[model samples]
Target: MRNSRRNFLQQLAVSAAAMPFLTFEQQAYTPVPHNRQGRVLRVALMGLGGYATRVAEAMQSCKRAKITGLISGTPAKIKEWQAKYNIPEKNCYNYETFDQVKDNPDIDAVYVITPNGLHHDQVIRIARAGKHVICEKPMAINAREGQEMVDACREAGVKLLVGYRMHFEPNTLEVIRMRSAGEFGKIMFFQGLSGFKIGDPTQWRLDKTLAGGGAMMDIGIYSINGSRYMVGEDPIWVTAQETKTDEVKFKAGVDETIQFQLGFPGGAVASCLSTYNMNYLDRFFMTGEKGFVEMQPSTGYGPIKGRTHQGALAQPHVMHQTLQMDGMAEIILDDSQPVVPVDGLEGLKDLKIIDAIYAACATGQRQKLSL
Candidate 1:
């Protein structure tokens, strides 16, 4: 038994020495300005999917963020991004070869824009490589996977940021500011409707294995996340009802539409809907004692229209992805925290609520959420 333990320790020591960045170097890392110029946070795109393409294009408008590396399973896609983004061959990687990214100095972080189910493994791999990770919404299939990803990144001394783009939007932040400033005068209720007519019935998003759930996992998460931020409190209980209009399209285990009610500790209540069959139905409404705030097309890609009982929100419009990348760059390189957090724990809270909502729907009872 002693010999076995000694051998295991020796192997662990060898692995640690092999991966130098896995040391306590990240703990000692302080936000150092590169020069008189702004800090640069070099990022690598892991998946070359549609969302990844959008993020790469928007990253061009970011001052402190640069696409310095590419990681994709497709060789042709990697070649295209390398040429288009001016990424050197050495900085490019495939999924199987991505672990070697720790040896490269130019890449500072990996953005995991893969499917919902793939986030857990890919994010852990990025942390093991000693790089920060920015995973897209629905951080993982469930809270268990999400927590594991969080623990992996924490152990690695790396940051795990979720791609909650709405958290960085100017108008949304303004509304949050108003609520914090007592403009809302004690929040009471919030309503979030997030859904779209999903295309391609055969896509992986409809697959339970890859997506973990149906419409709720894909677009419904926006409503869940929005409610938490708008209410400024975590939910204590959830009661949900799910409906499926098209069994063939949505599948048995997946949800086509779900209406959920969340009860908060401060007596605030949130009613939300997540669906795939609905069209042009992205909106959020928050009503308080003093006033109310409403946003139409709230979670869309751009030009989020919003207004309160006070007046029109005159906040300037910027691309959501652009603002999100720039804000994330500051968080990474400057050690700055955003007015609205987009960290892994923040993502975990949403996932936990999702788990409870699913349970509530299954049992036809109000589910308790300890988050």
Candidate 2:
């Protein structure tokens, strides 16, 4: 055993010597500036699912970014996107060959839109490829995995951004601005309800192993996120109750509905419900000492509308996803911070809350957040 350990150490030392030293200057990862003068950011889409397709369209409208590479498991989908996006045949890559993308100077970043379970591996791989990463929501199965991805990106000197569309929406941003500007006096409470009747039993969303959890992991995340933004602070503690309507339907790890409450730092409280057994009621309501702000159907695909106690907001009139993509491009290229918080840290906070929620549900007791 001693000899084997020594051999392993010697091999590791030799490998370390073979690798180039990473200096402080070499460690700096410069973002592409938003100006039109520089080269356009060449992005690669790692998954060709529905969300990936929508992101591709949004990228087309970005003046500073474009899809230059495609990675997909399905050969048919690869051929289709290659033709649609005018991606060169040489730039197309399968799952096995995706690591080779590190050598392709044309690809500066990668977007991972795979299933929830696949996010951790894909993000780590992309970060190792020395490319910036944009990942779909939930970030990972849990906070631990999310932190791993973040650490990997930081170590690789790459930028990591989560796909949080509402952070970039005009109406949502206005609400945040109003709250921060004291339009709403001394915020008091927040209420969020996000649910959808998921009909497909065979869908990956219903599978516990693939999805990590049920409605909470899927549509329920919107509630978790809405509460954080609406309250304008991370929750100090969480209490939750869960109900499984049909064990046969929801399965062992699947939850049909969950009611969770959050206690914020400044004596604020948020009540939220997330489910897969109900109709769409995605909304966010925040009440302050002055009045209230409400967003009906807040966390959906497009055309999110809202009004504050002051009055109706002036809509920017664009797809929420589109705005998010453009904003991400600006952050990557222009070194801009999002007006509303949507960084990896923000996403990680949400995941921490999620961890608490799951624990509360299991124990039937309130759980305090450590961070």
Candidate 3:
């Protein structure tokens, strides 16, 4: 929920002469109605995996959202979530019986937390079931699949939101707000490094058929998406480099580490890195003419810390997933758009960049982005 001071400040307009360099469009902040009273949005957790379990736990703290249904390939996991969340037997379903979810009025939406490659099909199925969808990031393995998911949801008249939780994170939003206020001057450059060492070599993420790619699809996307929003502009071109230390572990068609660069329309540039063989590299740094903002553990599931050239950010910490679920509830129930959008189109934009990055890496040449 947005505080009164911030709410009032968002409604205030700055003169074009006062902040000629700032993009006035990004400055308008939408305040969530903390006192909003309505029916709790019932969501079914699809894919009872690690992240899905985290979301389910966070939903318990959501004021306007509740986990009322479960869908999983593993019946044991489904039974666990059902008993833990007090979900009815009728709300439990496997992939074969998932189509029957269409008849369950208790469920208003399905949060697709499956692997990247599965999002396209499952999202379409959820839309066909007459339920809104909240798909995890990467939305799909490629832009084509992301667009299909978006089109299907639109055809079904149900909303499709991507689970880009960082967009709802407080500290990240503060940086965006500061950038929009001209505090960062004219944004000129961004640097993002996101990587983590993989533990299990045989995990589904290493399978190109399951993950679509390597680190880029799994965690590097944070750097890709962060560059766009932090710079407040779409990238016009991309150049990339891919390197693998162990061919056996990375396998063919999968990447271990990728370093990519994005050129924005204004000539502002972003240098990013994504890998699965490194640890504790999560960070984002943006610099404008006058000042800079820096964050360490930037995209982690945590108390993300950052400071601007002005001073320490001093922002309070909140669970990223908890804030995300509440913000999503408001988006679904009230038809309100968030300041940092997580809509399907936003997901598609990242996928387009990902596609370009991969092409650049493959061809050893700069790839143009239509987005």
Report RMSD (Å) for each prediction in the order shown: 11.7, 12.5, 3.2
**CA deviation > 4 Å runs, candidate 1:** 1-38
TM-scores for every candidate against the unseen true structure: 0.90, 0.89, 0.94
Determine the backbone clash count of candidate 2.
Answer: 2
Model 3 misplacement above 4 A: 1-9, 12-29
Q: How do the residues 1-371 of candidate 3 rate in per-residue lDDT, one tens digit apiece?
A: 24733753454333322554534235334556753876678999999999987898887778888898999999899878877999999999998888888999999999999888889999999899899999999999999999999999999999999999998888887787777667889888999999999989999999999999999999999999899889988898999999999999999989999999999987789999999999989999999998999999799987898888988766778778888888888888877657667999989999999998898988999999886
What's the residue-level lDDT of 6 in candidate 1?
Answer: 36
Cα lDDT over the full model 3: 0.86
Report the number of backbone clashes for model 3.
0
Clashing pairs in 1: none
Shift in Å, residue 108, candidate 3: 0.5
Lowest summed lDDT across 10 adjacent residues in model 1 is found at 23-32
Q: Write the per-residue lDDT of candidate 2 for residues 1-371, one digit (tens) a residue.
A: 23433343344345445657531111112223455467567889988988888888877777677899999999999999999999998888988899888899889888888888898998999899899998888898899999999899999999999989887776775676566556788889999999988897889988987888899988889988877776677778999999887888899888899999988888989999999988967889999998799988698876777788778766666766667776777777676555445667767877888888999999998899965
Point to the candidate with the largest TM-score: 3
Q: Top model by lDDT, which number?
A: 3
